[model samples]
Target: MADVPALVLDFGGPVLLTPFEMAVREPEGVVRDLFLEQGPLATRQRPDPLWADLQEGRLSEREYWARKAQAWHEAGGSAPDVPVMFESLYSPPGPRMIRPQARALLADALAAGRRTAILTNDMRAFHTQDWIDGTEIIHTVDVMVDGSVEGVLKPDPELYRRLAQRLGVDFADMVFVDDQPHNIVGAEALGIPSVWLDVTDPDASFDRARTLMGLDEVVRDG
Candidate 1:
């Protein structure tokens, strides 16, 4: 098939380092210690039954974070809820929030004549308006479909269809990249090619996307 003419990216995992990765940077405190001791970071080293529960879909994303926030609050951490927890976790955001490959992929795709867009479920919900307005990827892309703003969430075919319409491309002409498997399945169900970003190895994930879009030569030559 011809190279997909447009690229759609999920904002959180694929573009930004996950909250698990950011937890290490959090100031030394009960919340940071708690996350490192019992959360996904710990799960990376050993089996965390709670992480397993999340992976098994027994806990929704909100519930998982809410549980953490509640635990942290009970432990004397400042954050008492999901939004507050995220704010504390992602403080002083700037270019550091973006993965380097995400910047290159977005720039290279646009340079190579592909429309680029971000389809995010939480940019607005989890981040402050000032942060959103100043984020590099928010301004770099040709289009941005924010689910929180639209009252829609991903893995919902309607959001995908809306992004395709906004990008002026058919589903088959776009390549969607996200770290979530369910989102990949949803895009693929509508004939949109997709890259499942491995949050553990984002470079490899971006390499897969660059290869799928045949962007290596274009970026190399330019």
Candidate 2:
């Protein structure tokens, strides 16, 4: 095995551009505008008391998603469930959903014989089977541990431990990256080095991961 630190990445915001980002950049129609443009990204730009419930942990991620899915269905979206809703919102061109920087980082890391894994809370929950199978990053990674499949979510210490155990690496030798603060803390609590990805400034976060993993130059936007 390569002696370099193993890299663990969260799937949503860290690996794929979040649905919110996609929605804002690629507005499909009324459904996109209703559930996404008026939801998370909107909450990010302006304070919404309900969204605050999510930040403060009063609302579970599932609860928030359920609310959005329900609203979308009620607003005439064809997909009634989260998974279908997600596929509809995200659309085809699966590879394009991945951040370019993330793609570069994973390519270089794997090329260097580093072990990389995706630890996601919602890979299975929010995606169709075909989508997961077709996603290049999903196939490229050394391993993927999803909470929806494993019946646990991030910020839960057990999830972190399970990932380390599966990789057969100690927490000290792994670098974890996640966009959620709570998930980062969970990994760090176990002595894992982590980078909290700032979605607004993603390049900076990827730079920090590169430094921590002893990788070469950062991926610059061209």
Candidate 3:
């Protein structure tokens, strides 16, 4: 982690907070609850086949949703009302907060003259650039390698390498943090020191990350 010139952050669980992670943290509302409310058959609904294509920018957002609805019905579940589900599931009540510790860590890295980038397996079905653009976190980011835009996702070493190249940073000197163990292994395989963050335990994850980055302890609220 020495001589870390850049920090490559994962968007979902590591940087921008996600409901999936929150479900694990709070244990009150799980993702399956939504499906259960729809119908018992809804639980059998499989992932949309066009999901990857949609994320990779190969399919239009509208087409993805239509295909997604079709996928649900095909799986014996009543298709969700797209608008209602979108607001209830994707756009929850919260304005989605970034982990406070993550924000602090990025700020510290940037203040110390380190470059920061966001590398995420994303679905750009709707306009979310506003979230990133308007957030304070964007100020620290030097590049964002989104799967939808890049047509590549994490655990694909090529995506990480391409992101590194795009940021003009050597893989060896980049510090990456992802919540997925598979992604961590993938980055490490490329000789990049990567941290596995447990988003449910953000403070502990960031503490371990600070240790990996050769940084001293920091106090930040969740």
Candidate 4:
């Protein structure tokens, strides 16, 4: 670990587990189909594009949800059940922890006196109790910059800058890790180094820039 000491983490893909096939893709597909069938006008309104923008912080979640709900109502759907949809999207079949490798890396870093922090874009009201309950991972971090709490989301320079300020570290000394390429690119643009945790690729190596195969790696690398 560097003496300057700071590691910024993305919650969803790196620490909090995500069910790619079920919670993500499946729900996204279901929502898309629901929109297509009930709200044909959504095509003209471009709900998907709007959602992407919202995710990237180009639009507020409240605004996105309001517009989406209106579109669903106009399309003859029952307001698209926003809360239920989000619950389904984030509620994985089983809670998951980072793989042992990643955990080790993080542990090593922390043991070496590095500060660890999380920077994630998540809903304000979404409770993370179920995911962190009885999990040792929560204790590993020094601070958590939840987007909901910060009112700023990733892919935006504001979020990155705010986190660096809060941590009292320079952007160049901070390393951000997330599974999404766009997120990595966004952090890179702000002069923060990034690690892409591509869990989908069996042959992908996390060794490039302190990437980890799993949580164990974090402990070991740390």
Candidate 5:
């Protein structure tokens, strides 16, 4: 870990603490049903559509919301309500806390002078303001490379490469962590070592290169 020059973090599962499944559970199904009942044209230009564009850094939040509002009007859906929806999507059920050990590990890394950044494939509709309010974890990072702002999605080597470039570090010199296996594999293919974080376990034990509990062990081991 000390040898590594930079660390790349994933947002959804790591830094931006939220129970995404629950947050979108109700709205997602309803939205999908609406889309199914309607045509692609009616739904394709909506806020969620900005998801892809945001992932590719092709659309900004402001632009996405405006278009979405218009799309909703055209589709006869309720007028696009950005503030309400944004708050609903990004708001957490309760206070989201960082894993104490994980936080300690990150603080140590930063104290040791290592560079760190956030690289998440987040939704376009969700704003960073929600993240700022919801969690205290993000304050530890040096950079925030959100896919929604970058216009690139993970599992895409280009995104990893771009992040590395932005951090001014070589891919091999970085260690990335994410909860998704595919994302881990994708980073590995690019020569970036990665750890798969599983935050649900009570014991918090992780297999080699795969973390089920927290990143303390990985940081210590690396």
Candidate 6:
């Protein structure tokens, strides 16, 4: 077993690709952001109660989005294809969504003798046991604490604590990497060091992560 100096990373945006993320960083992303974040009908990250539960893997995707579609309609937006759009956007087992930048950072971490794992809030796309272990970029890091499987998600101190316990490491011994600011805050709140991956430039993010974790292997220029 590798030394239990753990490096916990997020899957979406940071490691794996998702459509919602693509939309966020797209060339014309601001218009999409307005529709998704700033519009009158947008949830603005304030997910409805059911959607919030969905993030924690407590509710089925269908149940949560079905309710969300209703709310969108009531608010004068016609987003009836919420479920299809979500699934179709993030269809896994494809080449288009693979992100090697985060994978390379993980490989470097392992080479530096640190145990690494993936912690994600996902439902369908990332859970394929056969496919994930066989992929070149993905197979290097295997200890995954996925929300769909663990019934918890990031920004939840319980999940972070649970991961530390499962890895047999102290809270201070773990360094977390994610693309979300609030998730970073959550991890840091539990005394776990965290690295925030810049969605626009993951390479720089990993470099920043290395500095925060005091990792000195394979430094890259920003």
Top TM-score model: 2
Please provide TM-scores, in order, for all candidate models, with all chains considered together.
Answer: 0.88, 0.89, 0.65, 0.60, 0.57, 0.64
> Cα lDDT of all candidates, in order?
0.79, 0.81, 0.64, 0.59, 0.58, 0.63
Native-vs-model 5 lDDT? 0.58
Off by over 4 Å in 1: 1-3, 37-46
lDDT of 4 by residue, 1-222 (tens): 233536677765566543332323344444444444221123345456764675576876557666665554565545455544445444442334345435655666577567788787773344455544545675568777777788877778898888887777888777777866678888999878778876554124245445422334555564
Global Cα RMSD, each model = 2.5, 2.9, 7.4, 6.9, 8.3, 6.6
Residues 92-154 of candidate 2: C-alpha lDDT, one tens digit per residue: 747678898888888878877789999999988898888888786788888889999999899
User: Residue 12 error for model 4, in Å?
Assistant: 0.7
Deviating ranges (above 4 Å) for candidate 2: 35-40, 43-46, 217-222
Q: Is candidate 1 or candidate 5 better by lDDT?
A: 1
Candidate 6 C-alpha lDDT tens digits along 19-97:
4444555455332432343211226463346535654657765465565545545554445445444443444555456
lDDT of 3 by residue, 1-222 (tens): 336658788876677665444334443432443233221122235443354465455775457555544544555434444443333344432335567788878887776677789888763433255544555665668888877778777778889878988888888888889866767888999998888886446798887777766555332321
What does candidate 2 score on TM?
0.89
Q: Give the better candidate number (1 or 2) by lDDT.
A: 2
Off by over 4 Å in 3: 21-32, 35-96, 123-127, 217-222
Ranking by lDDT: 2, 1, 3, 6, 4, 5
Scanning candidate 2 in windows of ten residues, the lowest lDDT window is 35-44
In model 4, the runs with Cα more than 4 Å from the true position are 1-5, 21-95, 123-135, 202-205, 211-222
Per-residue lDDT of model 5, residues 1-222, tens digit only: 234546667765554433333333445543443333221122343434554574455775356556654554555544566544444444662333344434554665676577878887754445546555556567568877767668877878988988887788888777787866678888989888788776554124223322322345545776
The clash count for each model shown is 0, 0, 1, 28, 8, 0
What value does the lDDT take at residue 48 in candidate 1? 59
| Weakest ten-residue segment in model 3 by summed lDDT | 34-43
